[model samples]
Target chain A: MRKFFPFFAVLIVFSMLLAACGGSAPTEAAPAAGGEEAAPATQSGSTLQTVMDRGKVICGVNKAVPGFGFLQEDGSYAGFDIDFCKALAAAIFGDPEGRVEYRPLTAKERFTALQTGEIDVLIRNTTWTLTRDTELGANFVATTFYDGQGFIVRKDSGITKLEDLDGATICVGAGTTTELNLADVFAARGISYTPLVFEGADEATGAYEEGRCDSYTTDKSGLVARRVVMADPEAHVILDETISKEPLGPVVRHGDDQWFDIVQWTVYATFTAEEFGITSANVDEIKATTENPSIKKLLGLEGDMGQKLGLSNDWAYNIIKYVGNYAEIYDRNLGPDQPTYIPRGLNSLYTDGGLLYAPPVR
Target chain B: MQGTVPESQEKIPFWRNEHTLQWIAQFTVLAGVLFVFWLLYANMQRQLEMLNLPISFKFLQINASFDIGESLIEYSRSDTYLRAYLVGVLNTIRVAVLGIIFATILGVIVGVARLSNNWLVNKLAAGYIEILRNIPLLVLLIFWYTGFFLKLPDVKEAINVGGTYLSRRGIAFPWPLPTETYATYRWVLWLGVALAVALGYALYRQGKKTGRMPLYGLWSLLLFLVVAGIGIVVLQPYVMDYPHLPDKGFNIIGGKTFSPEFMALLSGLVIYTSAFIAEVVRAGIQSVSKGQVEAARALGLNGFQTLRLVVFPQALRVIVPPMTSQYLNLTKNSSLAVAIGYPDIVHVYGTIINQSGRAVEMTMIMMATYLTFSLSTSAFMNWYNQKIKLVER
Candidate 1:
């Protein structure tokens, strides 16, 4: 027992030393504000380099949202957000088809995936909010789809307006802006309602369809998309009132400005191509014949615009050449002919009285 | 010889000594474990700091900014995350406690029935045990939820029995609501409870000394009820609040409600856990020696008395230790409430983690909460087991 005492003391001392080392190591390695500035020098293009080395861009996306990001029967992803991911892959590898791997993530898992470097970019239909931007250590590169919270109820339920929803049970997807917005708007109106929060949109919509809930609430676009797949789409109607602004977009981890720039410019490249009347079908012709300076620079006919973003000069050209412009991507996934078609109201170009305005490439 | 060390001990070097080597090995393992934990902690801290997300519990003070569907306490979107978390804790306790009680009762009955002389009853109990024990709890929970509860008729076509309403929305039943005079009536009720306990203790002691046991429990219950009856005449404590479905509204108001989520979760947990508990109880009963039952029968005791007074007390000694584990499993399995959208601790923690981005802190709190519940339950069970434990002179 006496001899064991010395070993116990040594063990205690060793553990204490380890604790001390662990406690102080983070302070030395991560100097808070100083770390952010110093991070870029050490890890500016790290994500890009990793993606290039791995030969595929790993994208976290939604498998549930129909028009934005949906998993198809053939195991391929096809949607508006997926197109953005493809556009990003095109910008990086000059090929979009085989250069992207999509990881379908829940709303609760999207931010964590970005922070943990599990995915290079998150293209889920995530709304941009102040708390998420500042607290979640995420950077919202650009708003690809401007949506707003809305409610959908059975047409025969007589719930035509928000006031009719008093004392109603509303089904909402958990851990999304839709849940918070439902609570806020209803509470502000002094409308007492029970929010049946489900972990996924599929469950929430299923609950609503089963009459377990009186109404289902989510983004207007999501409501449109989910409604189309219901047992009887014409039996339900989205309410006219838009409850809260939900600017959905792609997000990346903070402190990686180069990656952020790449994703941001990838989005802008699509918008600019649309503004310049360039489609995948017409991009090659435009690139060969256009003498306009901005078009030339955007199409990689002149200058080093893509090089400034740590890419080959043909990056923007590749994105347009493969994934097409914003208009083409939107029309393909959510066009008027599609079952989940949502009219491009705020998603249209600025010249067409919408909010999608891209800054000049030059 | 008294002062001299053993020859083997003398020849052993300190480095090769068993005691020293064992101590060194233990210390090395301990050091290795500590180093690994420290490495993980340091890595997490560094990553969080680099991402500008410092680990802080201050987020608990922020407004939860979300509404829980059903909470025992008065909660709103304006409440703090701490309050929301407490609501979650209370919900978990409610389900766990109720699940433990119901599961034990059903398990004991089924266990006793499994050994019955009737062929049909024994086979039915066996079938129940086999079927429920085989399926996973989460699948059963989802089946009970989506396939059973959610498939109930809509609010408009709700099945109403007496004053209670059952629908896909939930079950709403009449509950007692306190009137203004309830505060004054509560003291009399407490007095009755105290008097009943005192009388029961006195009767128990008298029975022990006289060598003839009395029905102390039944007498105490009767005494309490007589006192309660007299109190009710003098002061009415509560009025029954009957639920009423308004013609146009979606909800059944004015009474207590068991949300479909809670009902499904409780039923799933009880049914799943009762199967294992029934087997434990059956084994415990079987562990009681046959000689004890024969001896009780020879002493002229009835079949019920022999089983209750001789067999059960002995069986309890065997039943308790394993029974504690079943209780713990049921409590832990209640965390699956998240899958069914019950506002349990894990569900609320998920929301909090999303809203605050404090996954580390919230996870710690959730784990601590579950640990506290499990520890408290096992501690109580351990105490009870000690009290009923066999003693020898």
Candidate 2:
């Protein structure tokens, strides 16, 4: 032990200096701020301050969920979640180009990454569940999209709905809420099912395609993207009935209530912008002529909303100008006209008869 | 320096004394290491508190609410986190215990066979060691599971022979029916094993008195069967149970079921480690002097007799020490059970760390468990090694 100390002493000193110097840099602290710290105050909760100080918002994402959170062919992250990542960056630093650093994590590793302060905020389309919020010590903000359990079966199987398959094997991801829902749905229908659980969705989808399992069950959105790679994509059909509510949203660790409110309100700002007839192309025009008092206040044209949140007066303005409002982001990624071709469904603004109602800024 | 008295003595200052310098260096390093460790711990505590993470281990008492696929002791989701950890510990033990025994036996055979004069046998042994050891354990685990085992026919259409069920689920053989009479099974098995051991001792004692130890294995086998037969009769009517399809579900309802996951993981571990152990044993054997075997052969001993008496006993002194480490390595590598979902100690603790948010405590437990296993195995082998030392005549 003694002979090794001189060596270890140098190591200790070097590491200490490294940590101190690292605190000034941006990358290393992102995981520490976003992960196991379980609160952002130690690292990420004062996110805008960190970004302003460091000039980047660290975003945790998933590269597997195509159209929601996935990588494109060109080695860039592009999906619905990616847009929100841009939205958060645009809202805070007022620059959408390079203010965000995205780290894609596996489904099981996402929460630990957030708790340990690795990322500033998690926008990985994770489900908001009681166990996650309370027991795991994470705080889920407003829902970004409301989804439910659905399945896709080979078109030749002649199975169309949830109750159609009785003894068929279903492939689902292990350690996911999907596993539990798969069990409950089969139990409720008085049908017995063989659940072949894989560690990841990619593997499960592969197994299903190989006919190891008769069907694969996940969120309907996931099923669509999964089927595109199948040998016969048109042969597979997603069940119409959605079982088990899955409200996918962003999350931050508990504590730092102030930090939670900031990320939450940023998401609401996107919804609120869409509700007030806001779009990236029209944002500049509205900045000059918008007259509604609440809208005016929200856009930082009236009260000191920015001061209360420790943000710029035109924080929401920058968000709309750069990232676009909620509808614009959705249409670009998951809209029927987009390559993904998913319906807006519950993601539209309240004026469009959907559930995306944002609170009044005042 | 020549010193002090008229008798001429050497004296050195404390710092200049070699012994004193060594001591000082040791203590200084120890103190510095301890200080840095304490500092890291303090920083962790401060960070954890600052972030308001529940760093305390109050959550271990909470219900785990997660069922294990394979458990030696009774485990349920309703059990506490501590119980879940114990289940993992038991699985670690179960795999390690069986793997060590099987690897040692297989390793010795292949090790000895590698030097065989026979054309077919020597190359085969060499080939087995090279191919298995060169590939990584994870690849072999996948090969065992998805590549071969998962390709078994589904349970509903499973192959059944002589009341045994074989399917993708895994091989399920008949177990003794758990009847009131079958409760005496332990006594019968133990008594039979004890008799066999006693028979071996008797043969050794007879060898000391007379000039020869008869075929002790034969005596031991007869003793085991006689005792086992009598015990079985007394413990009467032990029935056999076989696996069959459940009336209303997909699960197998009867007989002893082995999940394919456990079989694949264990086989991979055993095969990979055995290959290394085989090389160790071969080197140990080859290191033994040819004179030892020549002397035994000149004494009119046959090949089997010479090997059992001369080659193996001496070679064990070398083989046992490294063999102990391979056993410990197998124990630690059991953590790979997670990749294949075997739910060993690391996997359960990983979940506990995630659920309870007790990273420091859980990590300490994992390290301590492995360390204790390694130390205990080393201690046993060390004792055995001392007993086998070549005492100078």
Candidate 3:
């Protein structure tokens, strides 16, 4: 018996191992994809109200995808997704600092984390799709960014368009709509292609640069991001065709219409802020002097909107003061005034006809 | 095994005993653990209901609306999610099976080389083992995929090895084509397997009955090949699926073009694992005593016979346990395909998680996959280990 102590210890460890393997929370078995609809009301029940009452928001986003979500070198979340998260926190709790917690997620883990209620809102530049909404049981908010699937190829390859590359091999990141869409669009067109799938964008793009595949496809923004770092930027060509409809947006699980309403209104508030000529730099001065009724109502002076949503009267004002509005966020993070210099394109204010329209501020 | 004798110094009272406390402590701990798990589970359920992250697997029945890159079984966007996952399982098994074969061969060769008297072979084996074992497998996979394979020239500039297509895209080779197509080919497959089994069994019976040295395994293999040839003639299920260039325009629609992800991962795991196996083999070989070698020599046996009959049979006793462990490691390492994007079980589950928006569920699935893999591998290896274990005197 004494001699068998080691075996006993090992047996104990192995049994524990089995237990650990089997012990994963059964609550998360996500109903085989289609069985989700019936349970929506139950899932979104009390958790939404608790988050609202707590006066802080848990936001999940990616920290690696270049334009959508990324942690800056200084260790703060900085990207299109981050800005939107900040906007929501600003609208809900007023001060972006005390009101928000940013949780970074990988491409694969984002959906499950959302479903498990690990985070309140997912502001990642995730594509809104049929399966995701219906099967995954997530409720998508307003479409924040309109994107398309595009490809990048070497300059000398002389691959002018998608049709020219019929028999070409295309590289794409794994576990993404980018991968599925690549196959679908090409196959639908009767063009044959072999897909070289990769786990990470960095790896996929590396292979593309090394000429492993004749072409590499991803979101149009990702193509531009990869192209900029190439040895010779002018050498690569982005094909003119945008194959898929990518309505990128913020998401939360179904239920809690109140919280959902608050998040949706936050996104609109930014666009409205921009329309009202509010920028982070001048928000303080405008509050002191601006007497316009519309501006005052937006800034929470004349209207009881903040009370209706259960927040401080000046929640939008604080959001504008701390996080800035739509145009300010874009210029700081992407426009020519900043580093990445991504054009404001479709993300500009609605008054200027670019689709960054906020719902009426009333 | 010695029975447990009560410790000499501590024969205290009934309730005030260390043994009694030990049982109490264990029960308490067990109860505590269960309580904790229960509380955690309860909390999670509450939060889930509160957040509206409805759980469902109805997604499996619906069209997956996705396509996998390299599939052994038929997979299309039109297929269900379950089919996609099945394809992933097949891909994992494919690489794992091939990796084990190559690693075992390489390990035996290198293990012997390490014990060689020749300085070159000995030093070379040592260096190979050291280099491979030191680097992490994840890093090696990346280096192989990115620095080596992916850097190779495109299809136009691909390095052709004896007319076989080897490029960053994949390795293409000549293979049999289906003359009668896949549906009719089932009979050929069944006939081929049946013939192979019959051939092996007959060879075994012949060896046992004739009392002559019958090359059982080899003879049976040959017979099986002949049967397969007849099956191919009768069924005419497939033609030569030549992987010639014209047939591989954009994709090798006929012959399989093995992806570089599969190749790089397979080679990396095999090479890395073989180094450890080499050490195990070397130790096993050395563990065979000097007396056996001398006895073989005294019997006037040649070098090969002495090594094969006496030394090898002895060494196998020590070799199997560690070698089984190596095989288990290779299977588990197949999950590293997630990092390199090989679309193995982990990768597919990851996509499921992302698509479904269920993190805990996806993670549980990933854990279950590796756990199941580990159990099956160990079970098979242990059974084999028992089969070859020495009958000690």
Q: What are the per-residue Cα lDDT tens digits for candidate 3 across A123-209?
A: 877888887776565788888777889988887877788887887777887667887798788779888776767666777777777
Error of 2 at B274 (Å): 2.1
Candidate with top DockQ is: 1
Question: Judged by DockQ cut-offs, is candidate 3 incorrect, acceptable, medium or high?
Answer: acceptable
* Candidate 3 residue lDDT tens string, B184-213: 657666776777677778777886788654
Please write out the lDDT profile of model 2 over residues A204-255, one tens digit for every residue: 7866765557789888878877776577788788888888899998887676
Alpha-carbon TM-score of each model against the true structure: 0.93, 0.85, 0.81
DockQ of 2: 0.24
lDDT of 2 at B268: 89
Candidate 2: how close is chain B to the reference, as a TM-score? 0.90
Predictions ranked by DockQ, top down? 1, 3, 2
In candidate 2, what are the lDDT values of residues B221-323, reduced to their tens digit?
A: 9998888788777776467787788654344667897777678888888899989998999989988899999999999999999888889888888888888
DockQ of each: 0.45, 0.24, 0.34
Displacement of residue A307 (Cα, Å) in model 3 is 4.4
TM-score of 1: 0.93
CA-based DockQ, model 3: 0.34
